[model samples]
Target: MVRTQDLTYSYDARHILQFPDMHCAAGEHWLLLGQSGSGKTTLLHLLGGLLSPHGGFVEVASTRLNNLSASELDHFRGQHIGIIFQQPHFVQSLTVEENLLLAHQLAGFRPERRRAHELLAHLHIGHKSNVRPNRLSQGEQQRLAIARAIINRPKLVLADEPTSALDDHNCEEVLALLEREAGQVGATLLIVTHDGRLKDRFHHRIFLQSTQA
Candidate 1:
């Protein structure tokens, strides 16, 4: 469901980071491991079409991301890619359910309250569905982030530093939840992290070296 070839990017033309070719079949899980400045996040953004690559190509679900217009890319990403950032971001003015509904609407799909509620219930945050995101606890917020990311049943799920802030137990729980949820939807999952604990959990792993070095 995801593939990249000769992907390269740079900020100011001094250091161009080139990534190794990658291919992940549908529903497969992967670990993208790299140290700081290794371009792990850059590759994730390129795959999601958040940043245009300087060279090569990113294909997600068979679509060439580099060829899409900004608007088209936004639509395609919203519909096909679900991203879990290191920090949870949400619409402060909207309730948890509303925020998820917004995700549907933004993706050009009709808002489905039933789907939002179902996801919240599945994540054990159904009670907080009407509450503002800021009112939730840290763990609840993390679960909510997972819910939002998979709310659309996206084809690809990319998580960035998802376990960075958690204790070992919470980290395990989070990873389990992420995998289970993505698997439930048959979505391919890729997690980008520096954490070594995950190295043993996933069978398919890619370790990236800093191109600058």
Candidate 2:
């Protein structure tokens, strides 16, 4: 679950971003819609504990992110939050399976190769398990990213512009995968995107408006 109150951030005295109070219950799916400069990515980072808010709080899975130290936040995020960025980032030097195992190791859990392979199989990229990430096609890479995100069965899944680069068919496919996979683990799913095409896909949504609008 997630809850935010009076969340505000600014780079300087002249500019500020204010976010609406929002809440998502356990296992709920939400779309965070906004235009560019509406603080969608900023808010996502705050929610993921990647950025410290200049004001207010971001709570996830009942933990107040503002209260955590940098190291603690990193650990907590690894264990509880799964983030899918607009561009998938991976350890190119490592094979797909190795990269997933790294996630488990970073989260302080014992590596489970069987679980990792099962996720890759579920994502339809089982054959790419031993291949380096760079060799995969775009769609395969995307699916691999999904596999990595949910591999830990995180409590909260946050995706940033997940469908931005896909065609309609791929867009729908990715969204369905995200929803179904997250739901399987009873995780709360929140996607932050400016894509209008996603507006009708999710029943719960929050709009981040540009302060200058």
Candidate 3:
């Protein structure tokens, strides 16, 4: 679950972004629609505890992010928030499976090799378990990113412009995977995107106006 109130962020004295209030229930899916410079990504980072807000607060699963120390926020985010960045990033040296295991380790949870394998299989990439990430195709890499994000069974899943680069078929495929996987984990899914292709897919949405002032 997520709740935000009077959220405001500033890059400097001259530019400040104000975000609308949001209340999303657990296990629900919502879309955050906004144009470029509207602060969609900035809001996502605040919600994920990746960026500290200059004003107001972000609460996720009942924990207020503004109250957490840096280390605490990092640990909390690792355990509770799963973020799928627009671009998938991986440790090129690690195999697909190893990358997943590393997520568990970083979260302070014991590595679950079986869970990792099962998740990859569920994502239809079990065969690539031992393969390095760079060798995978774009679609495969995307699936790997999805797999990595939810492997910890996080309570909240935040995706940024997930379908921006995909063709229609691939875009739908990726969205389906994100929804199904997040559903399986009982996570509240919030996707931040400017893509019109996604508008009709989600009934619950938050539209942000450009806060350029």
Per-model TM against the reference: 0.97, 0.97, 0.98
Q: Which consecutive 10 residues in model 3 have the weakest lDDT in total?
A: 204-213
**Per-residue alpha-carbon lDDT of candidate 1 for residues 11-45, written as tens digits (9 for 90 to 100):** 87788989999999999999999998898889889
Clashing residue pairs for model 1: none
**Candidate structures ordered by lDDT, highest first:** 3, 1, 2
TM-score-better candidate, 1 vs 3:
3
Looking at candidate 2, what is the lDDT of residue 165?
87
lDDT: the better of candidates 2 and 3: 3
Candidate 1's displacement at residue 209, Å, is 0.3
Q: Is candidate 2 or candidate 3 better by TM-score?
A: 3
Where model 2 places Cα greater than 4 Å from the true spot, the runs are: none
CA displacement after TM-score superposition, residue 36 of candidate 2 (Å):
0.7
Q: For this target, which candidate reaches the highest lDDT against the unseen true structure?
A: 3
Better of 1 and 2 by lDDT: 1
Candidate 3 residues lying further than 4 Å off, grouped into runs, are none
Query: Each candidate: what lDDT?
Result: 0.92, 0.91, 0.94
